[model samples]
Structure formats: structure tokens, C-alpha cells
Target: MPFSNKVPTIYDPRIGSPMLDAEEANFEEIALKSLGGFVLVLNDNGEIYYASENVEGYLGFHQSDILHQPIFDLIHSEDRDDIRQQLDINFHIPTSSPSNQFDIFAPPNSKYLERNVNARFRCLLDNTCGFLRIDMRGKLMSLHGLPSSYVMGRSSTGPVLGMICVCT
Candidate 1:
């Protein structure tokens, strides 16, 4: 099934285990393809849990090759620290807050905070291409109690991260 931007609806019948609705599965694929990028989901430890198939076209690595691997492993060494810092939840917490609690500029200590990153990633298919520049936009996802079927690989019982990366 293709990925969709909508949260897949779990359909439960009296005779079967819950399953994703077929209609919503293609939304993610359409969204990603339109953007000309791929999606990545990572555990708190930064291990890859899922990578869209389009990654092969953009980064030259098959999805299987990077699954269960550290995302940092594929990042250019010089850019690893920067990417790590941007993804670090602690780094986003504001040290001071505006006098008004409702200020939009005030960073919220919430799981939904979004992160943006620009970095260079190693190209596995062609070493001659060296590293390719990538821009990523994503948000911290709280997946506690998320059904195993909703995510790829192991079931996530804690917070997970997700990103959409485009090559430039």
C-alpha cells in the first residue's frame, strides 16, 4: 500500500483484526510524489523505522539497506552534529518565554514541535556523486499506544520522529 498524509483509519470487523482502510493508503504516496521527496520515520534513538521507496531515487540507497540503521550513518560526518542538534528535543526548548503565555513566538514544550534541517547525505549508489544536499521538514510524533499495523517494523510505544526529505 502507498503512504498517505491522512492518519489511516483502523477498520475492525467482528470476524477480523483491525486493518487499514484501503482508500486512505494512497494519500501519502500522492503527497510525497507531488513533493518529489520521501518520508522517514525514526525511533527516539535515531534508528530508522521506515523510509519511503522513493528514497532510492533521491539517495541511491534501497529502503532495506537503511532500515534499522542509524540515520546518522547516512549523513555526511560534518553535518551529523548539526542535524543531531536540530533533532534534539532539548535544543528546542526555550530558555525564556514571552510575558504573554499565548504568544505564538514562544516555543511550546510540546511533542508536536516541528523541526527543519538541511544537510548533506552520502550517496551509496554512486560514490562519484559524493554527497547530495537534502532538506528535511518534520515533526515529533507521540506514538504511545499506536497500533503495530500503523507503523512499519516494530511497534512503537514511545515518541517517534518523522520527516519528509527532498533533494536539492
Candidate 2:
């Protein structure tokens, strides 16, 4: 008998490799579990790129069902606009003035900017539950080195915005 050697893959073969390795994925799962919230990644346009697996446990929607979908579709209609505004970089840009001219052009080196929002999200698990209020605290991150293939709308080289939403 001849021996055949092949490497085993952790993700679905049909979808190709995910950005995270098995160890990284496990670590993320543990961290999110401890925080008692699920992580959500969204593009500048509010399209969902990645969501932690724990989302199904908290929000009742599988990761596959929501990926590449507009996040607004899952939010309560009344709170959608507020979430949109918070995610928009333009909304947070500082006004230019003589004293703040340098500040406007040269911001801090931090990749993340603080973002906090409270909104009601539609619950898919139980009709009786309707919409569940969620508090999201996260950062508006600069998608500089992020893989474009992992992103929903843009290429890797361009200036892209992403948010890491921890919803509890």
C-alpha cells in the first residue's frame, strides 16, 4: 500500500481558508464568551463582513445567514439611522480651524476610535421576543492591512473603514 500525504483544513473546503487559524479561532471564541457578547465586523457601507460564531447564541442568526448582508436589515427600523451615523467616518471628522489645522491633518496613531451605540435588533429566534435591545461598544478601525478578500465591498489598498462591534 502507498501512503498519501495531505494537510487537513479546519474550515469548509468549499469556502476556502478563513483568515483565522484553528488556534486563533478558539482564542477569539473564549474571549468573546468571557465578555458575554458577540463580535461583529462591518464595512464602511454597513455590510457585515464577519461575525463571531457566538452571534447565533445571542441573536439567533447563523453566521452564514448574515455575512455579506447589510447590517441595517437586522437592526430595528427606528434605530438604523443612528447606527449608520455612528459608523460613518465623516460624521466624526473634526472641523478644520486655524488652531486645529494640524490636528485635522494628523490624527492619532491609534487604529481604533471609540464608538458606542445602543439599539434594538430584530430577534429571529422567537417571534414573541420581537426586537432585543443591545448595547454595542467598539472601535472604528482602519482597515489598512486587512485582507480585501475577507472584506465585502473594497480592495485591500484603498482606505477602508471597519468596526468591531461587541454587542451585549
Candidate 3:
């Protein structure tokens, strides 16, 4: 009998690979097709690593122009301080508590962007992006009594713009 990924991963090791639901390996494909929004995966330092085609629509700038830029630059100036506080709160929140994980503090001077525009700010390292992900969930903000229009997120550059930074 041969071991499956389960041997090291799941209880069923000798049997054939468990078939995932129709939604198995196709999650990315399905979501990508359905949502049609940009998915940017930033490193702890906030550099743009994985940006989807939808990024252009989300940020107005082309992927080529934004690569290696700090995610913090796009944030509106007004929200920066509040966003910074929220990021601090997020960093301190316990990892096990998902409820404490998100925030709703919008960036300064940022109303829901009529058009996407992002700017990058350099960090003290002069080479490394400073932003660590301050994970913000839009749905969570609404659940916490924040209005749907209120922006939610964090930036490494400084504070946030329109996006709300929910602090603990």
C-alpha cells in the first residue's frame, strides 16, 4: 500500500487522494472569475509581490508601474495617523482571536476612490518595504457597526487614507 498526502497530512494515507468538492483546486479560478477584483499579496514589508490583472482597476496604475512600490503610498493622507494606530492595535492583538483581528479607520482625504491610485513610500531601510500586513476585512467592518462605505485597511508607509483602520 502506498501512502497518500494524508499519511503525513490526514488520517487516510493508503487510499487514493481524497477528491475535493467541485470547489477543490478550482477555488482561485472560480473566485477570480466571479469577483473580478485585484488581489495583492504583500510581503511583511509591504512590497507588491503578487498583483492580479484586476490591480489596474483597483489602483488605476498599471502593474508594471507599481511593482516594488510600498503599499503605504496609495493611502490618502488624512487617514494616516488613524491607520497607524490601527496597525499598532492589530500587531498587538492575539493571533487566536479572529474577532480582534480587523479594524475600521479610514485614511485622511480619501473618500471611496472614484478611481484607483496608489503611491509607494520608502522606508528607513532604504531598500526594504516597511509595511507588514494589517489584515483588514470589509465584511468584518460592517459586522462591527461600521458603515459599508467606510474604508478599512493598514499601510506600512505611515497611516491610512480613506480605508478605516479598526483598532483593538
RMSD of 2: 9.1
Query: In model 3, which runs have C-alpha deviations exceeding 4 angstroms?
Result: 1-30, 82-168
Estimated TM-score per prediction? 0.62, 0.68, 0.35
Higher TM-score: candidate 1 or 2?
A: 2
Whole-model lDDT values for every prediction: 0.67, 0.73, 0.39
* Model 2 lDDT-worst window of ten: 1-10
User: Per TM-score, what order, best first?
Assistant: 2, 1, 3
The residue-by-residue lDDT of candidate 2 on 1-168, one tens digit each, is 211222333546687653334455356456768988888888777888788888888788998999989989999899989888878765555555343343322457233266789989878777537788999888877656556565554543336777788899
C-alpha RMSD in Å of predicted model 3 compared with the true structure: 14.9
TM-score of 3: 0.35
Candidate structures ordered by lDDT, highest first: 2, 1, 3
Give the runs in model 1 whose Cα sits over 4 Å from its true position.
1-29, 97-112, 125-128, 144-168
Candidate 2 local lDDT, residue 153:
49
Higher-scoring candidate on TM-score, 2 or 3: 2
Query: Over the stretch 1-168, how does candidate 1's per-residue lDDT look in tens digits?
Result: 433355556645775554666666677677778877778876555667778888988888998999979889998889878777765555565558443343323365453357778878887666548788888777756545435655556454334554433434
Give the deviation of candidate 1 from the true structure as CA RMSD. Answer: 8.3
